[model samples]
Target: MEKEHRAYKSHCLVLPYPSQGHINPLFQFSKLLDHKQIKVTLVTTRFTSKTMHRGSSGIELEAISDGYDEGGIDQAESIQAYIESFWKVGPETLAELLEKLSSSGCPVNCIVYDSVMPWALDVAKKFGIVGAAFFTQSCVVDSIYYHVNKGLLNLPLTDSEISLPGMPPLEPLDLPSFVYDFGSYPAFFEVVIGQFSTVDKADWVFCNTFYELEEQVVDWMAKFWPLRTIGPTIPSKYLDNQLDDDKDYGVDLFRSNNDACMKWLNEHPKNSVAYISFGSFAQLGLEEMEELAWGLRRSKSKFLWVVRESETAKVPKGFIEETAEKGLVVSWCCQLEVLAHEAVGCFITHCGWNSTLESLCLGVPLVAMPQWTDQSTNAKYIRDVWKIGVKAQPDEKGIVRREEVEHCISEIMEGERGKEIQKNAMKWKDLARKAVIQGGSSDKNIDEFIATLVKR
Candidate 1:
């Protein structure tokens, strides 16, 4: 009887939209479930499994076909083509994987799927299992998308300011790029808005944010959906240190020069280095890159910048050699480790949701240089709502000038405003830690999820 019970333990399969940012939070959440003695399997596409720099996540990994076994999204003709193919093929393979797991004696009882791929929940329903929608963005951003999906917020801004429940008035620019710059990337816009298509049917709606961070929005959304805030879903060491060996996200799609970056940071003075990265997918134009390069040079602050290998040429000619004494430019470094270092005083970022949350959780002030998508909205919060950073304003040409970049960096690093921003950053950091530690808001929510799953 004991053996049979152990063999039939409740299991959850976590499915993330195939990207580093999407995978990391879901994987961290899977680790949380695994730590609670729940059997967890992380689902990746066959292509991503082949491409990623696999790390020791200490959990089982399984692959499903995204209809592009050979090359994934890059092989697809366009974003729409890729999404359509995945939607058609994902359900069939997912059902097959479920059957395979069931015959293997570890039947999956639940699926925690990326909200963007809502069809996964339909598969879970077909299998008579619980389906949890895992949203990998801020509640405010999700709420905005939800509103747009429900036709509450019409497109092509005619209004000077927009009002939404549980959020302050937002300007046209403060809205997500998908909404503000309507039709810019219609396929991606569809993917974002389509998240709400079947979300009402999910057994649980999980947002990767803590209650303290977005209490008002979370509460408002909870009234309509079974919304739960269970995140900052970063590794435990940086926040509460509750989970053993939870230092890094444990999986990377890109390589990092860990030793070199750490060594350079170690040599810098405490709270002196400005750590700059634009996450993995953002691409800046050559002119913008040139301006940014010179801007960092003008700031006269010691900096460490992650310029992806593809963008290396865009860095102004001789800029690397000229700034070598004060700045270290590398392809990539372990961002969490760099942010946690005492030498990293401020972050100059593209304001991607994951990067924004990481900076907020780690107590690092920011200079928000938003690129696109949900970034503009996040940057708005970072500068106005959170009071932890200042946004670098772009000119009418939608290019942030070198002088503006220097000013934003200076404001965070040396100006009187820097002191206030630093204080707010530390305050959010403590709150973030408290949310994930034992008996805290996010911890309790995770416990509730596990308890409900076990009961089912």
Candidate 2:
């Protein structure tokens, strides 16, 4: 190793897809690297960078444009237009940013990028820095994508059940929404399918999941590439059972109402509250929103919901007022704190991977209401493979009715089924914690990965 490299001060430029789900894990991973005494810089799109709360002391933050930074690709006409605009501008912009960073004394030794942006690997290779693909989603989902790209699995799936080696059988509904309806989201479908083509070109690959949690898929992927399990990329405070001081990831795309939500949770009886959220991006139809409202009220469970302020218009006019005593609705809250709270018995979620892992790590059972993308696969794992949650099935019209929602809520929060799921959830929580502490599976993987990075 050269003198600078011999010092083990590897500087890594981390780039995450600009979405809230993608940014959080990469940012947390950056913090972990900084904690390990590596120089870290997290890069995001200009718009996402603006929304982040700058609190982490050791990490550097930077931004590159995705062309439509003012409001992001939401302003574009379609998914195709949005992504095309991103490709037209993102790669060149990122290349310039890396060059500037290198010339200004912080030469990057490696590039760790979210797999969604496969084009980043090319840019990193051009710069002669090692490229590592970081998956913000589950290893199972990534493996599924790999199969799809390899033409081993067909899309708009014809079978009621799709089987993959080492994973539970999946129904069409269990696959990502994009798989069934590619026409409506051609750009997103393309990006997801194309990610694997360049994934093998990278020096290393990381998943925000622990080996114990998805051992089958993690092992399956390692046979194909230099894949490593180095996560539950949540804060060490939650996963490692460290002190509460390390809780916040220090970046919030949405403003949080932490104090009010925490206070509401505190007043509930132990393990009595049903915490509901659909993550940052999923939007519900007005009919579906009204159904969920009535369902929560009918279940008569103490509930805390995080609905975006913009979506509140969909709720029945008198719904919030009628359930005032039983339910608290906020625009957003610190999800980790709420999930960690003693009163939270069940999480009614859209089954996003981050939410899935968080619920598992904190021992909160789930009411899976998967919406789109990888959420469906995540919901499948929660309800079937893990058995720590119940999947809320929708009707023929694709609406999860109020009665169905109520039934699921009751079963997961009050029935014998709830007790079983809760026990399983707690078991997984202990395993997740074990995988993150010193000498644990995830910790050891991260330690070895860092050692490898320094040597490179």
Using lDDT as the measure, the top candidate is 1
How well is each residue in 162-236 modelled by candidate 2, as lDDT tens digits? 898778878777778787665557778899888887887999999999999999888888998988888888887
Model 1, residue 73: C-alpha shift (Å): 0.5
Q: Cα lDDT of model 1 overall?
A: 0.92
Give a tens-digit lDDT track for model 1, residues 73-125.
99999889999999999999999999999887668999999999999999999
Worst 10 residues of 1 by lDDT: 1-10
Q: What is the C-alpha RMSD of each candidate to the true structure, in Å?
A: 2.0, 2.9
**In order, what lDDT does every prediction score?**
0.92, 0.86
Clashing pairs in 1: none
Total backbone collisions for each predicted model = 0, 0
Candidate 2 at 100: error in angstroms?
1.5
Regions of candidate 1 where Cα sits further than 4 Å from its true position: 1-9
